[model samples]
Target: MFALSGCAQQASSPGADAPSGEEPAMPDNGDCPVIDSRDWKAWVNAMPGPGAETTLIVEGAVDMPTPGYTFSWEAGMADRSAVPAQRLHLTATAPDGMVTQVITTENVRYEGPAIAKEYRAAAVMCGDELLAEITDVVTAE
Candidate 1:
């Protein structure tokens, strides 16, 4: 005889055909898996799928002042020579109501074995007022 529950099986004899001690397995619906914090950069780099035509890449790291907060961003452009200039801006707000901005502008003058580009001065503005501005440039081959 076959019994569904343990108590019901006890009422029957040991000769019952039902298996003992093991329960039926349930189906698993995989929704979201956890990502390790250390692998975050790898995850971000893999966002654009295989079919992306034009690529825009931005990458930077942000340092936290104290206690508990941090921010980082990255981006990339596949065809750097296509556009004369490309502008990017990053804004962040801290828990204490402080605001920060990072701006970058790339200017292409010539194209050879190596590429030269300039990043216009970046501005850190708080609220409606500009706090600090600095000029920096980067080149990539």
Candidate 2:
């Protein structure tokens, strides 16, 4: 069984001239980039349930620079310490500006030292009927 106990933090600033598609030093959890709004639709639709086509936003506050670090999700099923963390459900509007449901299943799990820049993410599907999904990963900063 995989555990969510091990993870590290990563910090990087988006370069002034950085082009699109470049990943920035992301907080543990928060909003998806503004550019991701349109793409979020396909993501929510790819989940296992119908009507999961919304862009649910989750936020995390980090106290890194100190001792242990933490990540949190809004209305998420698992907490930072939930052993064998399973699934996370998020709610948001679809790309068309219509609201829909979104469900995400836990697939990839990671745990370890921050130096490795390791973390976990999952493939999420959304949409009332069905749409698409993309793999998202979370690393420290």
Candidate 3:
């Protein structure tokens, strides 16, 4: 239930100081990559309870400004009743102190009560931007 958004561009070639053959490091441009949907996973699992208790879990990663940044789910679900799909939101928060210029990868996850309708796909959103869309959903007992 989080909503986050940002723009990012791939870092250019390594600078003159960098050693040859070394991969170029991410620049301090404060930009994050748009996560590919293939990197995301969504699933539903039944829980132990008298009734049919179940939980929906979504896992993915987001590029943050620095290693000190943290990511989390927002607080509500988007209404996608028109389609057999679910839309989840996420957010990122930067640390309070000084941080390095390197871009960091933050793994984000969410586990909540499963909704009544089973969705065939799940879309991860950051504000109005679509981060990823998990089309293959797993259901487990």
Candidate 4:
């Protein structure tokens, strides 16, 4: 005759939470500056008025200020070496032919792009507080 032993164990309640293991780690992005365009494209819309101001709008913006429309791997993607320093200088000529310049500060950098669900979009103003004019608009991918 053989004898067997049995023991009963308690079960956890339905409300009890399960033990969670370690979470996955984020990929390493080295400190080196990456000046890639992230495959973003751009378009331009300019409405110049005879005596009035121009209207400008941009989309698909790269962060740190990479403004564009949609994504264009050909036109947008760039290696860190290919990334150019940002320039927003605007030059305007008045009716009298006097050339005036809107010196935009070098606020845009090549660190990376500012991508979100909708990309980057904005309406740029070139004039002063009372009257702002937008002559050129750049939208990107």
Candidate 5:
């Protein structure tokens, strides 16, 4: 299991019996009014399977100032260079209004395909801030 320091939130991945090459749907939070916090801890897990297909799961949690904040995995793009890497983007949004002062956590999850043995690392980013770097990628057999 991939681990992130100071992050207690856990993300679930698609089951092994699920159809191959089917991407999961992102949560609908398009109507949120305010942009939530970027303070987060991120992690990435690589699951290698047959046919040289690798599933990369990026997970993270943001520190919100109040409740009612929702987070989602915006996108994940692979940098195909001499050394490949995956860049996972995240966003946190909340309703417009004043809420009680309670610290909240919003978790995000992204599951996608990656070329097995190709990527050297995966980086999770929120806006311009780098949240986490995962270097222990499981290469193809």
Candidate 6:
């Protein structure tokens, strides 16, 4: 359940699982159940699980404008960091199969007046391993 933070915190997006204005769960030692709208800077160093395996998780939040829409997401590795992969990839794909993969962490936002009927954003760690996805329909325009 991802919610908007800093902006658009008052309105709930379509198909949202959590209510707006609700506070995100406090991070216990920089770990959270889901990477929602909360303080995530410390999440980078959090090794939430056991074993040498690493996992990448992406959490997305959407906002509706008059004739268009905007999406924002964040990526985190809630496990061991010293995995074999040197790079992490976060990809966004539309219903029409338009895929965008960002190697750096800053390209997590997607906005347009209807790129497709729906969008699926994913976080892939260690190259070929798929970790998580967040999908929802675009309600604006």
TM-score per candidate, chains pooled: 0.25, 0.20, 0.64, 0.20, 0.53, 0.19
Computed on alpha carbons, the lDDT of every model, listed in order, comes to: 0.29, 0.28, 0.67, 0.26, 0.59, 0.29
Clashes of 3: 7
Cα lDDT tens digits, model 2, 1-141, are 245544444454555345677734543333431112223311112233564332322222211222221232232232354221223433332243433333322222122212112213332322121112233433322
User: Candidate 4 has what TM-score?
Assistant: 0.20
Name the candidate that leads on TM-score. 3
Top lDDT prediction, candidate number: 3
Please write out the lDDT profile of model 4 over residues 88-126, one tens digit for every residue.
222222223333333221222122232221222222212
For model 3, residues 21-135, the per-residue Cα lDDT tens digits are 8645644323333332335898888646687667788997676646876666753565556435777777656678877867667778888777743667878777566778888
Model 6 residue pairs with clashes? none
Error of 4 at 33 (Å): 15
Supply candidate 6's per-residue lDDT for 69. Answer: 21
Global Cα RMSD, each model: 20.9, 21.8, 12.8, 20.5, 18.9, 20.4
Off by over 4 Å in 6: 1-107, 111-115, 119-126
Clash statistics: count for each candidate: 9, 22, 7, 21, 0, 0
Off by over 4 Å in 5: 1-53, 139-141
Give the higher-lDDT candidate: 1 or 5: 5
Query: What C-alpha lDDT, on a 0 to 100 scale, does residue 61 get in candidate 1?
Result: 33
Cand. 2 Cα-lDDT: 0.28
Candidate 1 local lDDT, 60-93, one digit each (tens): 3333233223232222222354322333333332
